[model samples]
Target chain A: MKWEYESPRKAYGETLVELGKEREDIVVLDADLSTSTKTAMFGKKFPERFFNLGLQEQNMMGIAAGLARSGKTVFTSSFAVFATGRAYDQVRQSIAYPRLNVKIVATHGGVTVGEDGASHQMIEDIGLMCGLPNFRVIVPVDSNEVRRVIRFVAYEYGPFYVRLTRPSLPNITSKDDEFIFGRGAVLKDGDDITLIATGIEVSYALLAAERLEKDGISAAVVNMSTIKPIDKDLIIKYARKTGAIVTAEDHNIYNGLGSRVAEVLVENYPVRMLRVGMPDKFGRSGKWNELLKYYEMDDAGIYNAAKKLLEVKK
Target chain B: MSDISPEKIRELKLIANKIRELTIKMVYAAQSGHPGGSLSAAEIFAVLYFHEMNVDPKNPEWEERDRFVLSKGHASPAYYAALALRGFFSEEELVSFRKLSSRLQGHPSLMVPGVDMCTGSLGQGLSAAIGMALAAKLDGKSYKVYALLGDGEIEEGNIWEAAMTAATRKLDNLIAIVDRNKIQLDDFTDKMVILDPLEEKWNAFGWRVLSINGHDVVQIIRALEVAKEVDGRPTVIIAHTVKGKGVSYMENTAKYHGKPPQDEEEYNKALKEIEEERREI
Candidate 1:
C-alpha cells in the first residue's frame, strides 16, 4: 500500500485555523516558538486570538490556565521538552489540578526532533503528563490523526496534553478514520500476537505486522492514540485473543506506551509482553531517521521484538 | 484619584482590623500556616475588596466582575477573611481553614468562592493575571485583573518573565500590588535577597510604578485608583509593609511567617494586640 506523508505540526496549525473560525473562544498561545510549532498559522489568520508569550513556558502554562478559567478554550504550544518539562509544575497545579479547559499542543516530541538532540528531545513527556491527575495524554500517529485529535480536544472541556513530532510521519490512518477519545484503533486484525503502538511508531507497527504475516504469523495492530484514559476493554479483548502483546513507541519503554499497557495488562489479564522503544538514555545529535534506527524504534526493531515475544508465548 | 473621605478611611481601617484579627485566629486555630504575609496584606485586601474592585459576593463568577489573584497564596488567611467579610462565603467558614474537607485549604484554591486562581507556589499569580487581562482585551470586556505578590516570592524567574510579558502586551487593565513586607520565611528580604531597587525594576520593565504604605487604607485605595487610570501599560504598586503588622511581638519578625502562635498565652496576647489596634482605629 502506498502511503502519503505530512508534518503533524502543519496539520495541527491548519486545523487550529479552522477551529478558530468555527469557535470564537478558541485561543492559541506559543512561547516564542509559534513559527516552529506551526501556531504561527493560526496567529496569521486570527492575530487577536493568538498570544506570543515570548520564550516563557512556565508563565505560558499558567496564563493558559487563567485564560481557560475566564471561559476561553485555550491551545498552548511549545517544544515538548519545554512545554512538559520546563513547566511541569504549572501544568500540574494550575491546569491539571483545576481541571481547566486548556489543550497543551506540544510539538517536537521524541528524538525525531533531530539535530536539536538530547537538549530539545523529550522522551519522558508521556510519563510526566500521565502522572498528573485529570490530564488526557494523546500522541496522534500522523497528520491525518493529528487534525482529528486537535478538533476533538478543542471541543472537549478538560485539560489535555497532545504531542506532535517534528519530522513528517507516514500517513497511517486515512482522513475518514474517526478519532474516538479514550479508544484504540485496530489498524490490523490477527490472532497470534498484538502490536500496540503510538505516535510515529504506529506506522512501523503496521509494517512489522505485515512482515510477521509473511513469516506465517498473524499479528494484530492497535493504534493507542490517547495514552491517558487508555482503552482498557480493548486492551483486555486483544490480550485474551492474541495471548501475547508487543508495545512500541519513540519514547523510553519505562513509562511510555509500554508502561501504560503493562499497567492495564497486569491488573486485567497478565500476558507476555515486549516493549520496543528508546533505551534508558539520552539521544544525541543525528538525523531523525538515524536517531530512530539507533534507538531501535524502527520497523525492523519492532519486527525483531515481535519475533522474540512470539517465541516467549510459544 | 477617587477621594476617600475620613469617614470612609475609618470604615476601611476597621475592615482591615477585622481581617487581621480573623487571619490571626485562623492561623492560630490551624496551628500551621503563614501569618506574617497575611497580616501585612490585610489593609490592601480590605481596600481592594471594599473600595476598588468591582466584585459581588452573591455572584462570585459574575462575568464583568474584577478578578484578584493572590500570588502570595500562603497569605490565604487574609484573602479568605476579606472574601468572607465581603460576603463571598460565611465568616464561620474561617475557622475550618486548613482542616480536612474545609474549603479553605492551606493555600488558595478556586473551590473557595471569589478566589480567582489556585496559587500557592510563588511567582505564578502574575502570569495568570496577565492571561485574564489579555482575555478581557480580546473579548472587549471591561473587567480588570489584580495580582498580589510577596516581596520574597519575586525571586522566582517566572515572575520576571510574566512581568516582561505584561508590560510588552501593554495590559493597562492589570494591576500588581507587591506586599514588600521586608521579611520572608527565614529573615528580612534584604538579608535574604536585596529587593531595594524594587520600584526602579518595575519602571524599567515598562510599568507605571506607585510606592505606598501598604497598611494605609487611604493610600492603598488611591494607588488602586491611580493604577486604573494608567493607560496602555500595566501598573505595580510597591507597598512597603512590616511583616505581622498588627501584632507587636510578631512585627518585623520572620519567626511568625509560617509559625502560628506558640501557645494559648501568645495567642491571647496576639488577639489582644489586634483588638487594641481596632479600638485605636
Candidate 2:
C-alpha cells in the first residue's frame, strides 16, 4: 500500500481526534506547537479536551503528569528535540517513573524537519526515551501504520513515546494487516541477508531490497517498528535463515535500532552484522533528502552496508 | 473565624514539638536525611494536619478530603512525621527512612496513603496541586489543595508558570505555603539568588498574600483561616521561619539544610533541649 499524500505526524493528529471522540478521558496538550505538530486539528474539534500550554515544554510535561495522575489519558505534543531533551527530567520523574498513562507525542523526528537546522532535528530522541524504564518506544513507518499506533497507544496502560515525522512519506502497510506490539513485519523475504529497519528507514530498506535483488543478491526486509520491546524472535529467526543482517534507522548508532539488533543477535544467533545510522555527529541544516544522503541514511547506504556484510559472511 | 483557645494552642504546640522530636529521631536514625528544612516545616505541617485540613486518616482517599503536596521533598522527615502522628501510617514506618523497599522513602510518594502526589522535583508540585484543585472544581467538590514550596525552590521557572496558571484559573480552593526559611542546599537563598520582594511578586501574579511567623502556633492557624476566606483568587501564606528553629547550634545555618544530626551525644543534647521546652509548656 502507498499513501496518496499524508505525513506521519498528520496521520497521528487525525487519528487522535477520532480517538478523542470515542473516549472522553483523552486530552491533548501542546507546548505552543499545535499547528506544527499537527495536533491543532484535534484541538479545533475537541476544544475542551485540548490544552495549549504555551511555550513551556517542561511545565507542559508536569501538567500532563498531573492530569494523568487525576485519571485522565494525556497526550503531550511538541518537537521531539524539546519534548524529550529539554523536559527530560520531568518526563523521567513525573510521567515515566510513576508509570502514568501519558502519551508523549513528539513530532519532527530525525533530520526530516529540513531547513530549520540541526537544533530542530531529534536524532537522539529514541535513544533517550528508550533508556527510561516503563516506556514503550514506537516509530511508525508511514501514515497508515501511525494510525494503527495512535489507537494502540491511547488504550495502552503505561507511558509511551511515539516519534513522528514532519514530512510526508509513502505508506508501506495495508489496512487489513494486524499490527501487533513488539512484532516485526516481514515486508519482503530473501535468503542471503536480513535487512532490519525501524521508522522512516523501513521504507528505504524495502527499496534497497528491490535494488539488491536486481544484482542477484536476495535480501529480507523486516520492519522493526517497536524499538524498546523489540521483536527479537523475528530478528533471530531471520538471522538464522539469512545468516547475515543489516540494521538501519534514522537515529544514532549508539542506542537506537542498530544497537538493539546487535544486542539480540550477539546473545541469541551470532551472525555477521552491519549498522547504518548517524556516525555520532550532530546534523547540519539542509534539505531533508540531502541530509539523509549526507548522513548515509538512504537506500544506497543500506544496500552498500548489506554488500559489506555479505563479504564478511562469505 | 472560630477563636482557638490558648490551651488548644499549647496542645498544638506540644504536638508540633513531638513532630520535631520524631523528625530528629528519624533523620538521626537514617544518618542521611535533611534536618533543617524538616525542622523549619514542622509547625506548618502540624497546623495543617492537626487543625487546618479536613482529612480522615482511616479513609486517606476520601473524595472530599483536602490534598497536600510537599514540593520541597527533602523535608520528607517532617511530612512523614506528621502523617505517622496523624495515623496515616504506623510509627514503625518512620524507622525505615531511606531504607530499600520501604514505603517511607526519602521523598513523599502516593504509595503512602496520605500523600496526594509523588513530588521530589522542585517547582513541579504546584502544578500538580493546581490540577487536583481543577479536578475538584470540575467535579463540584469543595476539597482544597495545599502545596508547600521552599523559598529557594521558587527560583525554578516552572513554579512561576504554574503560579500564572493557578491565578488565571482563579483556583481559590488552592493555597500555597512558602516555607521561607531563607536557606537552600548550599547557601542563603538571598546570597545564592535574591527572591526578595516575594510578597509583591505573588500579589502581582494575582495571588492573595498572607505573611505570618510560621513557627507561631497562633499565627499559622490565623493565616490559614484567612486564606480559606478569600474566594476568586489563590492564596499564598508566606511563612517566615528560621532554617533550624528549635536546635541552638543549627539555627539559621545553611550547613544543616541537608545534614542529619550527628553522634549520640549531640542527638541526646538536642533531645534534652526539646524535652526541657516541653516541660516548661
Candidate 3:
C-alpha cells in the first residue's frame, strides 16, 4: 500500500495561514501551545492577526466567541483535553449559545499524544463537544482532509470543533479529492459488512478492510470524519445494505462515533453492530502503539470485532 | 472623550436613581435575584444605556453600534431594568426575572434585545470584550467596546488573562470598569480575596487606570470620558461602590447580595427611599 507523510496538525496550521491571506476576517488564537499545536505557522506569517493567550483556555474560548460576535471568523488552537474539558462551560454559553463563527482546532487528540500520559490524552473530546448544539465536530482521517475541512468550516459560519492527532498518519485520500465538512467519505466498496471509523481509526478501518478482503469478507470502509452531522443518510443506507457493521475510533465507545452509529441503527436499521474503541477506561502512560494495542483500537482488534459480529449474525 | 457639563451630570444622576428604583422593583417581583450588585452597578448601567453607548433599541443587532458586556453578569437585574427602561423591551417583562420561562434569567443572556453576549460565568466577559475590540481594529470599525467586572469576579484567573491581552493589544477603544463594591456572594471581597492594589496591578499590566466613586454620576462620567482619549493602551476604571445603594438597611451588607426584598413592607420602604430621592432631585 502506498502511504504519504502528512501531519494533520501541521496541515491545519498551514491551511489556517492560507485562509488568513484570503480572508481578512480570519484570525488565529493559541493558548501558549502554538508550537505544539502547529498554529505557530499562522502566527509567523500573520503576526497582526495571531494572538497568543498564554495557556488560558477558558479566556481564549471567550475571546474567540467575542470575535465571532464582532463578525470575524476566529480559530482557536489548543490541546484537545484543554479545549473540550477545561473550558466546556465557556464553549457552551459564550460560543455555542450565541452560534458564533468560531472554530476550535485542537491537536494531540486521543492517546496519540504519545508519552504525555492520560492528562494530555483526550479520548472523550468528541463526546463532549458533539453534545453541544450548533457545534460541528470534525475528526479528519488525514492531512488532506484537514486542509479541506478548514476551508469548508470557514465558508460555513457557526461554531466548529476540529480534532487533530499528534502522530503522522497515512494520507489515504489524495489531495485531488473533494472533501466536504459534514459529509462522510466512502473509502472502499463491499456488501457483507460496513466498517465505519473516524480520525486515526479511519486508516485502521481501511487496513481492517484489507485484512477482511483476504479472509474473503467483502467489507465496505467509510471515513465518518464529521461526528456531529454523522451523515445520517449514509449510515442508514450502509447499515441496511450490509447486515453487519463495525465501528472503530480512538474515542470512547459511548457518545462517540460508535454510539452515534448505534443510534442510527437501533432506530432504523436494527442491524448487528460491533464497537471497537477504548473500553470504558482512561489511557495510561505508554508508547503510542502499545496504548493502541491495550485499548483494542488497532487493525487486529477491528478484524476480531468484525469476525465476532459476523458470527453473531450467523 | 468629551467634557461633561453640570447639567448633563445632573440628568445622568436622575437616570441612575430611576434605574436603581426599577432594579429594586424587578428583584422584589422576581423574589429571587441579586439586588446588591444590581443596585451598586445602577449608575454605570445608566451611563452606558442613556449617555455613552450608541445603541438603537429597535435595531439591537446593528453592527456599527457600540458594545457593552456586563462581565459581572449576576448584576443582570440592573442591565435588564436599564434595557427595559431604554425601550429595548417592555417594562412588563422585568416582572418575569428568574422565572421558568422568562428571558430575564439569574444571569444575562442574548435572548434579551441589546444584550451583546450571554455572560454569567465570571472572568469570561473581558476576554470576549477584547475580542470585540480586536475585531473593530481588524475591520477598521470605529465602534468601541466596554466591559464591567465585579471586584470578586476579578479573582478568577481568566480575568487576568483578558487584562493582559487587552493591555498587550493596546485596545484603546475598550474601556473596562470594575464595580468595586468590596462584597461578593457571602461576604466582603477583602475577606474572600483582597484584590487591593487593584489599580496598580492594572497599571502594571500596561493599562491606564482610573479610580472614581461609582455612585457619583459626574465623577463616573468624567472617568469614562478620559478613558476614550487614551490612545495606546486599554483603560480600567476602578469604581468603588456600596454593595446595596439607595436602600437604607441593605447598603454594604452581603445578605442583600443574592436575596430579594422579604415582604411588602420592605418593598414599600425601598420604594419610599427611591421616591424621596426623586423628590430631592
Candidate 4:
C-alpha cells in the first residue's frame, strides 16, 4: 500500500504552536538547533516564551530545570548528541534528580541522521536517558503519534525524553489511534514469532511482517513507543503466546528495544531472540536510506533475523 | 550606604555570627562536610535571609516570593542555618544534618522545604536562577532570582555559558553572587585557574559588576541592595572573603576546606571564636 510521509518534528512544531495558544505557562528553549529541530515554529509564534540559548546544551538543560521549577511546563529541543550526550551531567543533576517538569525533544536520533555521519548520529541516547530515574522515555512511531506526545507531555508533570528522527517516515499509525503512556500497540498478531520495534523502525517492522507471511511464518508487529517504563505486561503477554521474539530499533542492539525485551523475557519466559539494529560500529557519509540498508535494518534485515530465529526454534 | 542605619548593621552582624556558629556545629555534628566554604558564606547568607531578600519562610512556595539558589551547594551548613533562622523549618533539625533519611543531603536537594533547585555539581546553578528570572518576566511577576556560586565552582565552564545566557536575555531581575574566598578543593584558585580581572569578565559579559568585602554584613547588604537597581542586564556581586571567616584555626587552611574539627579541643576553640564574635556584635 502507498503511504504519505511526514516529518515528526514538523508535526511537533505545529502541535506545539497550537498548545502554546491554550497554555499560558508553556515555554520552549532551544540550543541553536531550533531550525533543524523545527522548534523555530513555536519560537516564531511565541517569541516571549521562547529562548534560544545559543549552542550551550549544558546551560540549556539547567535553564530548563529552573523554568519547570517556576511552574512552567518547559519543552527543550536540540540534536540527540548535544541534548543527551553533551549535557549528561546537567540533565542528571538539574532535571532528573529533582524530577522537574521539562520535556527534552531531541531530533536526529540514530544513524538515519545521514551524511552528517556518525558524529551527528546518537544511537546511545536511549541507553543514556533510560539509565536515569524519574524520566519517561518515548520514541514516537509516526507524525500522528508525535502530535499525541506533544499534548500528553504538555499537561503531564515531570521530566521526559522524546526522540525524533531526521528523515520523514510513512504514517504507520492512524490519526484516530490513541496513545497510552507506557503501553505498546499490537499492529499485527501472529502465533509464530513477535517483532517489537520503535521510532521509524516501526514502519520497517510492519513491512517485514507482511513479507514474512508469504514464507509460511506468522509474525506479530508491536510498536513499543515508551522505552523506559516499557510495556512489560504486553511484552510478557506476547512472550507467553509466541515462543520466539525479534526486537528491532534504530539504536545499538545493546540497550535499545532488544536489550529491554531480552531483560523482560529472560526473567519471565525465556525465548530465542535476535536483535536487528546497528552493529556496535560507526557509519560513514552516505544517504540515510543507503546507510540503513547497509546496516541491514530494512525489511530484508528484519525478515532475515526472523527466519534465523525461527530456524533456531526448529 | 550611609542611609542604612547602624542598628540594622548591628542586627545583621549578630545574625552572621550566629550563622557562622551554626555552620560549625552542623559540620561538627555530621562529622564531615565542607566547613571552610560554609563559614566564608555566612555573612552573605545572613544579609540575604534577614534583610535583603523579600521571602517568607512560612510560605516558601509563595508564587510572588523572591527565589534563591545556593549554587555553591556544598555550603549547605550556612544555607540550612540561614533558612532555619528565617523560620522555614525547625532549628532542631540542624543536628540531623547529613544523617540517613534526613532532608539535608551532603549537598542541597529540593527535598528540603526552602531549596528552590537541587545543585551539588558545580557551575549549574546560575542557569537555573536565570530560568526563574526569565519565568518571572514571562509571567510579568516582580520577584527577583538570586544564586550564590563559589569562586572555585565557577571554574566549571557551565558557569560562563550561563553567564552569557543571562546577559544575552538581558535578565535584570537575576543577580549572581560569587563567594570569592580564593580557595578551591586543592588550593587557591589564583594558583589553579586564574579568574582575576573577574570584574572585567562580567562587564564583558554585559553584567553590572559589584565588588565588596564578603565578611562585612554592611558591605554585603549594600551590594545586594544596589544590584536590585541594575537594569537592562544581570548583576554579579564578587564578594571577597576568607576561607574560614569566624574561626581562627581554620582560616586560610586548605586542610579545613572540606573537613570538620578533628577533636574536642578544636571543636570547642572553633565555637568559642564564633561565640566571642557574636558577643562583640
Candidate 5:
C-alpha cells in the first residue's frame, strides 16, 4: 500500500481551526511558538480566541487553567520540553489537581526534534504527564489520528496531554479507522511475538513485523496511542497469545510505553519482553532519522529487539 | 465611581476588624497557618468582597459575576472570613479552617463556595485572573477579574511574565492588588529580596499603578473604583500595610508569619487588640 507523509502539528492546527468554528467556547493559547507548534493556523482564523502569551510557559498553563475554570475549553500549545518540564507544577496544581477542561497539545516531542539537541527534545514528557492525576496522555501514530484525537479532546470535559512530533510521519492508519480514547489499535495479528508501539514508532513496528514475517516469526502490531488508562485487556490478550512482546516508542525506555506495558504484563500475565527505545542518555544534535537509528528506535532495531525477545522466550 | 461616605467607611472598618478577629481565631484553632499576611490584608478583602466586586454569595457560580483570586494563598483566613461574612458560608465553619474534612484548606481551594481558583503556590493567581479577564472579553461579558499578591510573592519570575502579558493584552477589566506587608516567612521582604522601586516596575510593565494604604478601607475601595474606570491597560494597586496590622504583638514581626498564637495569653492579647480597634471604629 502506498503511504503519504503528513505533519501531526499541521493536522493539529487545522483541527483547532475546525473546532474553533464549531464551538465558540474553544480558546487556544501559545507561548511564543505558535508557528513551530502549528497553533498559528488557529490564531490566524480566530484572532479573538487565540492568546499569544509570549515565552511564558508557566503563566500559559495557569492561564489555561483559569480559562477552563470559567467554562472555556482551552487548548494550550508549546514545545514538549517547556510545556511538561518548565511548567510541570502549574500543570499539576492548576489543571490536574482541579481537573480543569484544558487540552495541553505539546509539539516537538522526543528525539525527532532534530538539531535542537537535548535541550529541546523531550523524551520524558510521557512520564511527566502520566505522573499527574486526572491527566489523560495521548501520542498519535500519524497525522490522521492527530485530527481524531484533537476532535475527541475538544468535546471531552477533562484535562488531557497530547504529544506531537516535529518530523512528518508516514500515514499508517486509514481515515476510516476509529480513534478510541483509551483503546489500543491492532494493525496486524500474529501468535509468535507482539510488537506494541506508539507515536511515529508504530510505522517502524509495522516494518519490523514485515521483516519478522520473512524470518518465519509472526509479529502482531498494536498501536498503544493512549499511554495513560492503557488498554490492559488488549495487552493481556496479546500476551497470552504471542507469549513474547517488544515495546517501541520515541522516548526514554525507563518510564514510558515500555515500562507501562511491562507493568501490565507483570501483573496479569508474565511474558518475555524487550524495550526498544532511547537508553538512559540525552540525545545530541543530529538528524531525525539518525537519532532514531542511534537510539535503536528504528525498524531494524525493533526487529532485532523482537528477535532477542523471541530467543529469551525459548 | 461615587465618593465613599463616612458611614460606608465606618461600616467597612467594622467589617475589617471583624475579619481580623476571625482570622486570628481561625489560625489559633488550626494551630498551624499563616496569620501575619492574613491580618494585614483584612481591609483589602473586606473592601473587595463587600464594596468593590460584583459577587453573589447566594449564587456563587454566577456566570457574569466578578472573580477574585488569592495569589498569596497562605492568607486564606482573610479570604474565608470575608466570604463567610458575605454569607457564602457560615462563620461557624471558621473553626474548621485546616481540618482534614473541612472545605477550607490551608490555602484557597475551589471546593469552597466563594473561591474561584485553587492557589497555594505563589505567583500563579495573577495569570489565572488574566485568563478570566480575557475570557470575559471574548464572550462579551462585563465581568471583571481581581487578584491579590503578597509583597514577597512578586519575587517569582512567573509573576513578571504574567504582568507583561496582562499589560500587552490590555486587560482593562483586570485589577491586581499587591499586599505590601513588608514581611515573608523568613524575614522582611526588603531583607529577603528588595522589591523597592516596585511602583516604577509596574509602570514600566504598562499597568496603571496606584499606591494606597491597604489597612485603610476607604483607600482600598477608592483605588479599586479608580482601577475599574481606567481604560485599555490593566491596573495594579500597591497597598502598603504592616505585617500584622491590628495585633500589636505580631505587628512588623516575621515570627507570626506562618505560626499561630503560642499560648492562651498571646491569643487573648491578640483578640483584645482587635476588639478594641472595632470599638474605636
Candidate 6:
C-alpha cells in the first residue's frame, strides 16, 4: 500500500459540499471549528443551510436533533473532545435516545490532536459514542473512507458519530476498497496472524505487516472501522484462522477496537491477542507523530506486538 | 383579552381545568410522576392545544403544522391531557403513561404523536425547537415552533447557549413559554437558585419578552396571540404561575413536585378541587 497522507476532515468538508448540492434537506452545523473540521467548504457553498453555533457543542447537538426531526439530514462538526465529551449528555438524550438523523462527524479523535494535549485529545470518544443506544460509531481510516462514511450516514436514517483524526492519515485503504457499515474490510489476507486496526492505525498496521513478513511472520490487516454493531463474524473468522490476533487504534486500549475485538473473541473464538494502543492514561503536549512513537502506536508498535504474540503462540 | 369572547373564555377555562384534573389523576394513578410543574403548565398547554397554535391533531406529522417541545419534560401529565383532549391520542393511553410498552413515556418522545421533539433533559429542548424553527425558515414554511420550559430547567447553561442561537438567527417563528411556577423539586425556585429578573435575561439575549398570568386562561391565550404578532425576533413568555395551582394542599408546595396523592383522601380532595373549578367555569 502506498503511504501518501491525506486529510480526512478535508474529504469530510468536500463530500458535505457535494451532498449539499444533491440533497436540499442536508444542513451543516459547526461549533466554531469549521475551518479545522473542514466544514467551511460546505458552509462556503451553502451559506443558508450552514450554521456556526459558536463554541456551543451541546446546543449544536440539540439543534442537530431538532433539524433532523424536521426531516433534514443534519451534519455537525467540532473537535472530538468537545463534540463527544462536552456535549455527551446532549447527544445521548437528544440525538441517540430518539434515534434522530444527525451525523456527528467529529474531527480530532485520539492523541493525534497533539500540542493542545490531554484536554483536546479525545481518545475515549468512540467508547463514549458507542455506549449509547441507536448510535452507530465509525472511525474512517483515510480521506477516501471518510468521504464514503459521510455520504453513507447521510442517506441512512439514524444517529451516527464518525471519528476522524486531526493529522492526515497515510493512504492505506484505497478508494476502490468497498466500505461496508457493520463489516470489517480486510486489506491483506494472511494465515499466521491477523492485525486488526481502525482510524489512523490502519495505515500503521499495513506498514507493520511489511516489517512482520520480513521477520518471517505473514500478517493479515483488517480495518475494523465500525466500532458499534462491530463485525463479530470477521473477528471470529480471523481468530479461528490465524490462532493469534493483534489490534491497534489511535484510542485507548480500553473499550476501543482492542477491547471490542477481545469481547467478541472471548465469547466466540478466544485467541492469543495483543492490544497495541495508549495505556489508560492522559497524553501531554507534543508533536502528533512524536506522540504516536512515544505511545508506541506507530508501525513498530504493531510489529513488536505481532512478534510478541508469535512468541507466545510458539 | 376583550376580543376573546365570554363563551370562548369559558370553554378555554373548562379545558384548562380538565387538563388540571387529568394531570392530577394521571400522576396519582401512576403513583410515580410529577404533578406540581405539570399543574403549573396546565393553562399554557390548554391555550396552546385549544386556542393558540395552528395544528391538526388528526395529522400529527403534518409538515406545515406548528411544532411543540416539552422542554421541561417531567410535566408530561399536563401535556398528555391537552394532547388527548385535542384528539392527538386517546384518553385511554393516559393510563399507560410512564409504564412499560406505553407510548406515553415519562418524558415527551417521538413515539407519541404530536410530540415534535423528544425532550426531558433540561436546557436542550429549546435548541431543538430552534432547529425546527430554523428548518421552517429553510423550507420556507410558515409553521411556528413552540417549546414549554421550566424556570428551574433554565438554570442549565445549555438553555443560555440555545437562547443565543435563537436570537442570533433571528428566529421570529420560535416562541418559548417558561412555566414560572416558582417551585422545583427541592424548593421554591428562588431558594434553590435565584432566577429573578429572568425576563431581563431573555431581554438581554435579544428576545421579545412577554409576561402574563400563566394560570389565567384568557391571559395565557392573549399572550400567545401577542407572541405570534412579534416580528423578526423570537418570543419568550415569562408566565407567572403558582406551583400546583389547582388542588388546595398542593398549591405552591414543593412536595408535590415529584409526589402523587398519598392516600384516597388526598386523591379525592384533589379531584374535588378540580371538579369544583370545572363547575364554576
Predictions' DockQ, in order: 0.81, 0.61, 0.75, 0.90, 0.80, 0.87
Tens digit per residue, CA lDDT, model 1, A1-314 = 57999989999999999999999999999999999999999999999999998889999999998899899999999999999999998898888887899999999999889998899989999999998999989999999999999999998899999999999989988899899999999999999999999999989899989999999999999999999989999999999999999999888888898999999999999999999987888999999999888888888899999999888777
Least accurate 10 contiguous residues by lDDT in model 5 chain A: A1-10
| Window of ten residues with lowest summed lDDT in model 6 chain B | B1-10
The complex in candidate 2 yields a DockQ of 0.61
* Model 1 chain B weakest lDDT span, ten residues long: B1-10
Whose DockQ is greatest here?
4
Docking class of 1: high
Better candidate by DockQ, 1 or 5: 1
- For candidate 6, give the docking quality class from DockQ: high
Query: Relative to the unseen true structure, what is the C-alpha lDDT of residue B229 in candidate 5, on a scale of 0 to 100?
Result: 93
Stretch of 10 with least lDDT, candidate 4 chain A: A278-287
lDDT string, candidate 2, B1-281, tens digits: 79899888988898888888988898888888888998898889999999999999999978779888898888999999999999999988897898886888888777887987788888888877876777666567888889999999999998999898888879999999999999999999999988989999999999999999999989999888888995899999999999987887778999888777778888887788888878877
- Model 2 bad stretches (over 4 Å): A1-3
Model 4 over residues B221-275: C-alpha lDDT tens digits? 8888888885898999999999988899888867888999998999999999988
Model 4 chain B: worst 10 consecutive residues (lDDT sum): B1-10
Docking class of 4: high
User: Please, what is the whole-model Cα lDDT of each candidate in the order they appear?
Assistant: 0.93, 0.87, 0.89, 0.92, 0.93, 0.91
Q: Give the lowest summed-lDDT range of ten residues in model 2 chain B.
A: B130-139
Q: Model 6, DockQ value?
A: 0.87
Q: TM-score of every model?
A: 0.98, 0.96, 0.95, 0.98, 0.98, 0.98
Off by over 4 Å in 4: none
Candidate 1: true interface contacts recovered? 0.69
lDDT of 6 by residue, A1-314 (tens): 65778888889998999999999999999999999999999999999999998989999999999999999999999999999999999999999999999999999989989999999998888889888999999988889888889989999999999999999877676788778999999889999999999998988899999998887878999999898989999999999899999999989999888999999999999889999988998988999999999999999988988999999999
**Tens-digit per-residue lDDT, B1-281, candidate 5:** 68788999998999889999999999999998998999999899889988988999999999999999999999999899999999999999998999998999999888999899999999899988988988888889999999999999999998999999999989999999999989999999889899989999999999999999898887888888889895899999999999988999899999999998999999999999999998899
